[model samples]
Target: MLGAQQPASDQDRRQYQRVKVMLHGRLMLSDRTEHRCQVVDMSPGSAFFATDATAKTGERVIAYIDHIGRLEGTVARVRDDGFALELNTTPRKKAKLAAQLTWLANKHELDLPEDRRHERILPRNPSGILSLEDGRQYRCRIIDLSVSGAAVEINVRPALGTQVTLGNMRGQVVRHFEDGIAIEFAVIQRRETLQQYLS
Candidate 1:
């Protein structure tokens, strides 16, 4: 489902290059309602998103994409399957977006894998308990598991680089997403036994 859209002129009749991506995220409307969506195509200044929620043209939207982080924009147009957003960002943010898009483009062109070092899997039993260094524990939902890292959905977000324990595995917070943080394990996990501790 990840494929580029044909180059089209924007509302201002300016054509911007776009790359195909299948990034999942939550879309927050002006009324604060959130819905799950997938970003189908993205450019530095705009993106095409597919979602079940409907919004009128010009409606404000705040999306927290997986790798790209938060993006604020206004609905520019609606398609049968989705809508387009005209992004509102500073010059610096735009530059970052450009770089991300380029990286995605090249990765796709070269057929590179996202995580080549480890094979990631969705745990059959996704529930786990996360404990902070202070001994506080919170229930967490495992998003995905890899030999080197795991993505978990938890309410408490510790500072970056904070050491934490998920079940019996120890790791440090390396990245944050809308739903949770990504932890890179202190030691590589044996793929055969990783799922036992995660559950």
Candidate 2:
């Protein structure tokens, strides 16, 4: 829990702490392209999916969840037949998905149901880092993530509306908090920004 802390509020607590389901769905990378997929697992922060074709690491993909809704993200890693998605956008979805997950978690409470939880350990599995346009970089720990935005923790706080980049994803500093910063995801790069970083 080096960079981890309590959720900013009760609402954040309920939303971030819940375990979510990964229902089967389709992923349409291009508007005209679609592929069959099974959402093997999900969390407030990320998802693991299985598809016939493996997407290259850092490639951006657009996904549609059955009841949880849709998202846009980049491939964290690729396997022979599937891949792991480290969400570049997914905060609002977390709240919506959390409500759905709460119901499911409660349902499983009584029954001897199977656990469907997924956890992401960072640094070793680091999702992304935060950088100011001015050239300062802060190690960012994601609070909750979605295809639209993410709540991140930053040591040096910026003012509201201050634009910054996480990995290669860009957003504005929407709000400040006691232990971190909240970044609203803005322009999600269609291609994996990691390539630019490596090259």
Candidate 3:
């Protein structure tokens, strides 16, 4: 996370465990253009991202990182605010980029981003259809999890704080953004459900 003051131009741009970079241009992935995203932070292995677009976990995209440059990433998790990107193995290129990333992270002594600052653990984002009670199945991605809450990203925008069900877990929407919902678990205990589903 960046402190209040901007780094002086003459000063080296610090690399954080997560680094925020203003997106420079529109990027295309899967016939869709993902616009207006800020890099939350990055390492050579992976970078966290915040975007206001409809995206699914495990989806891969070509992302352009400032200084470090553009590379492909796999969606790891989704949240109301945004989703996280994980690096995939590509032998030669991955090794080279990873070395570069480690250098930046060490040189900057970067702090963790807000999303990762807490001790909370979230579910690994899944790519699949969730069948609802009424026989309607929705395409959604697991966002995050806590003992009392969880979040999901769906194409439909439900009202703020609305109660919704995902699988056997039920929770209330704590926050709503352009393309996601932050739900507070109300029915299934967070630990139990995560274990069963993830296992």
- What is the full ranking by TM-score, best candidate first? 1, 2, 3
- For model 3, the superposed segments whose C-alpha errors exceed 4 Å read 1-26, 110-199
* Worst 10 contiguous positions by lDDT, candidate 2: 112-121
What are the per-residue Cα lDDT tens digits for candidate 1 across 19-89? 88766668999999999788889988899999988888989899988668899888999988889998876
State the C-alpha lDDT per candidate: 0.79, 0.60, 0.54
Error of 2 at 24 (Å): 1.6
Clashes of 2: 6
- Worst 10-residue lDDT window for candidate 1 reads 4-13
Per-residue lDDT for 173 in model 2?
68
Q: In terms of lDDT, which candidate is strongest?
A: 1
Clashes of each: 0, 6, 4
List the candidate 1 regions with Cα displacement exceeding 4 Å.
1-15, 115-199
Best by the TM-score measure: 1
Cα lDDT of candidate 1 equals 0.79
**Model 2: runs farther than 4 Å from truth?**
1-22, 30-32, 108-199
**Higher-scoring candidate on lDDT, 1 or 3:** 1
